[model samples]
Target chain A: MELFPEKYSQAIEKALERYYERYTAPENLYSPARYILSLGGKRIRPSLVLMAAESFGVPLEKATDAAIAIEVFHNFSLVHDDIMDRAPLRRGHETVHMKWNGNTAILSGDVMMIQAYELFESYPKDIFRDVVHTFNRVARLVCEGQQMDMDFEKEEYVPMEQYIRMIEMKTAVLLGGALAIGAIIGGASTTDVKKMYDFGRCIGLAYQLTDDYLDTFGCEKTFGKRIGGDILEAKKTFLYITAFDNTTDKGALRDAFSITDEEEKITAVRTLYRKAEADKAIEKSIAYYTDKALSCADSMPFPAHVRDTYRRLAVSLVERKV
Target chain B: MELFPEKYSQAIEKALERYYERYTAPENLYSPARYILSLGGKRIRPSLVLMAAESFGVPLEKATDAAIAIEVFHNFSLVHDDIMDRAPLRRGHETVHMKWNGNTAILSGDVMMIQAYELFESYPKDIFRDVVHTFNRVARLVCEGQQMDMDFEKEEYVPMEQYIRMIEMKTAVLLGGALAIGAIIGGASTTDVKKMYDFGRCIGLAYQLTDDYLDTFGCEKTFGKRIGGDILEAKKTFLYITAFDNTTDKGALRDAFSITDEEEKITAVRTLYRKAEADKAIEKSIAYYTDKALSCADSMPFPAHVRDTYRRLAVSLVERKV
Candidate 1:
């Protein structure tokens, strides 16, 4: 199981290099794309696709197209997201829009999207229809999720359930799509694909919950940014909502949310969060979904070693620091 | 042939209605889409698609999917183009970004693109691969054209040939794709499809050249906006470049381009353009391509009625009063 970690990681790195090369253009239109792709992240989506392919008894190289497609799609969303959020930095470097202009970023993002579709087109003709159909459905949901996120900005209230649905559409569905794509290409049955999708969705939810926790409590060395950015932006993350619902000292928490002073707001919100024990709730939720995700994986008909590797990766994703 | 115009227009109107109905949530998100789609442009690309389909003896409805796809893709470009150009109005009404925020405009444009692909996916499974492949290639070229357009804003010296290529990618290829899709789906031979694509490419170039001429000389009622906007913006339109290359009065032309005063720049540029007979040059260039486009369409094996209808439409487009 431990050896699988290094194996998939190396495979992802190599696949990304080839994928990036295939899409590069002679014009500088791809310069920003290259820059952003090279600004490294965890490559979690691609790794999952590769790992799922291996678990299905297909070699990692056989699943390279699906893995690359998912990665390109993920980065495409990130580029447009940075433009919409007015985010200047990504992975500690200038976002595509910040480095270039908005028009360049928008066009480059459009090209990246086309590139993603091109990668999907590389699959055999027998699977092409299903792959494209699935890709289109997932792409639409991602846009729907983005629309909901923007809608939340204007509304006064968003229920916990609605927020969860938004995350499912925006984040989890793509991860599930990644796994499902690998399974489909690896010749898995419809039942197995659905099971893999369920497994991936559960892990995706846990992954986001852990992200919320880390945003508040993680050390700078591990988390890569200052804690409480979501608080500063009034992001309506899980911790804030949980504290708002559970805390008895409502006055301070309410005041903290409205505070204009940054330091005062952070301190006040953190205090209320601590008193409500919101971190404990977040941790418990992460573990619950993580366990559910692993259970789904266990039910799959893979070899024991492959199943164990998938289970361990699920746990480590929720528990990892940097 | 005249009756065919009404038939195709109604078909396009219905398809656009169905296209707009696909978005169910967040009325605001769909509002801009509906607003843009309903603005009632000439439906030129879709008309080309239908005409090409009919020329090959395919029922117009069979080509409806490709027709709608091209129209959707065109509107997608317009929505984002409005944002990039910071234009306040489109089709004499508020643009998407003006009616909504830039984020809403951007996200809607993104969804519009996804819808374009989804519409493209409606083709038969046998033709699906070619449809996706061609559309993907055209999408990449459109992005390249947009990048070049932005690049032109910074560079003072743009060759005439480069400008032609830029517009070909940015504006013509989709029209080319429209005709190509129609022909392919209509069971036209590969040779016939190639000829139709050439027909579209040539006509699109002529159409743009005509637009350039009309911008400087056509009546406000006929042209739909202020005349000489390109001159005021110092845009490197065909007229400006041809005048720049041929005119003996360099100082006056340079002053016209460099002037900051709105009225002064407009008067100065128009004066030099008239003196150099740039209007005649523009007219000649437009006629040159229009003739080429008609010749290309004539050389195809389409029915005489189809050929004559297209020829009439092309001439009317360049010679219309309103």
Candidate 2:
């Protein structure tokens, strides 16, 4: 089965476009929101929301608004994170802060976050409360995760367990939250909803780990981004942190990260990553998470074909070159 | 009756302090939130929430969480707005962005916003959805208002109607929302809740207009801020906007605004304002809103004492020397 079929993407895009039509005034505030939404991401989290709703036998319309909310929220986070990171580009376009200004970006992102919550109001009262509560928890966790990520940048040491927890909170919980919201709206059983959340969490972990892996090892032709960008920045990805644990000579690994030349730094870091077998460790971790997601799918109430489709999604995500 | 009784203020302060104690981790994220909350303001909005609940015959405990939510959200906006406005001090203390940093302020503000929403979960399901929907709308309007305020700083012209709408959105709506949320949770009739909202809104307009008036004309010792500060900043306040409209020699007024010396500019602007009768106009508008608020309070379905209390509250807000 195809992963993230065109039908799903087109439906999401149409709904999002329709939702944003009401915000034409205050161009400075809403334009950045529209610009970021139009930048065409994979929409993976929203797709998980849709897929979970469908697997629970709900109509597409029942979950579309929640999906849009998740997408809008993700974009909101991206806009603010870009401002915080001082990033000039996103999806090969100027970020909101770069295009307009930081204040515009901040305020626009804030409005987008509120709009995301407003979208959830279409559900029934009980469902709305549950979904909002779930969203609130996940949103707070994402902020906490971001704080931890920023803190890690300045800290000299981060435990491996703490690093894993950081990735879980930063990226994985939102994926879990997306699925849980869809399932709850679909009237799924509590146990089944838990299973769906766990499934998304596992897949999210694998997806982020694979992304870290591909930054250094992806095929240049298919990766779409320049490989080794993370290496040049000395980002403490799974490879870097684990390599410190696995390498016999930690000083050499640190020296490799400290290389001045970009190309030389990438090569040296990749070599150290291999020598320390952190690459293999990360690959094993990725497989572990993917398998965990598959088991979660198997335990869920979805039928054989739906389970097969979910399995295909996990494989496709981890297998992506870009 | 006192506008905001000491008992109500103490209750709100204790509730807010208890609410913030749970957020100890990620010091960078929670500390700013705590810091801003600790710099106690009048707690007027939360007091409105508690007042509405009590007037509606609901237990104060039933509304304390929502009151805290409003207070937290108010501080969240302040933290972000201070960054955007480059404000150095708030309540005579260093702004969050100054005390910590811009990134910390941004992220901490974001978390505080999410926490505000979470506080509403203590309500029942239907009331939770209603209160959240109201909060969402008011919150978005506040952002739009801030955007318009910023835009006005750059633009040469703004209609008086648009300026009123801006102030309504920027400050009035949240006060209205506080009352609306409390009334909703208290099971007040829809019409009564709306009256409560309108009362807060009228008083809010009067309060903000009074603030602008005091900025130029208030006694420095009582106001706790420097007089004529708005003139120095050339803020497009009600007085400035009206003076521009009412003055015959617009060129002289413009030249007066461009005066290099701070004292001279204030004196010139004040003279121009009096010449155009703009100060009288502003006073008239303030009285209009105050009367409107009193009428709203009288129309609400409450005892004579409650209505009398509301009348006194509106009067005190508009009649304050500071």
The model with the greatest lDDT is: 2
For residues A78-154, what per-residue lDDT tens digits would candidate 1 score against the true structure? 99899999998999889999888897787787788888888878777757777777778788788888888888877
Candidate 1, residue A19: lDDT:
69
lDDT of 2 by residue, A64-86 (tens): 99999999999999998998999
Cα-based lDDT for every prediction = 0.82, 0.91
| Decoy 2 TM-score against native | 0.99
Highest-DockQ candidate: 2
Model 1 whole-model lDDT (C-alpha atoms): 0.82
Candidate 2 global lDDT = 0.91
What is the Cα-based lDDT of residue A225 in candidate 1? Answer: 91
B170: Cα error in model 2, Å: 0.3
> What are the root-mean-square deviations of the candidates from the true structure over C-alphas?
2.3, 1.1
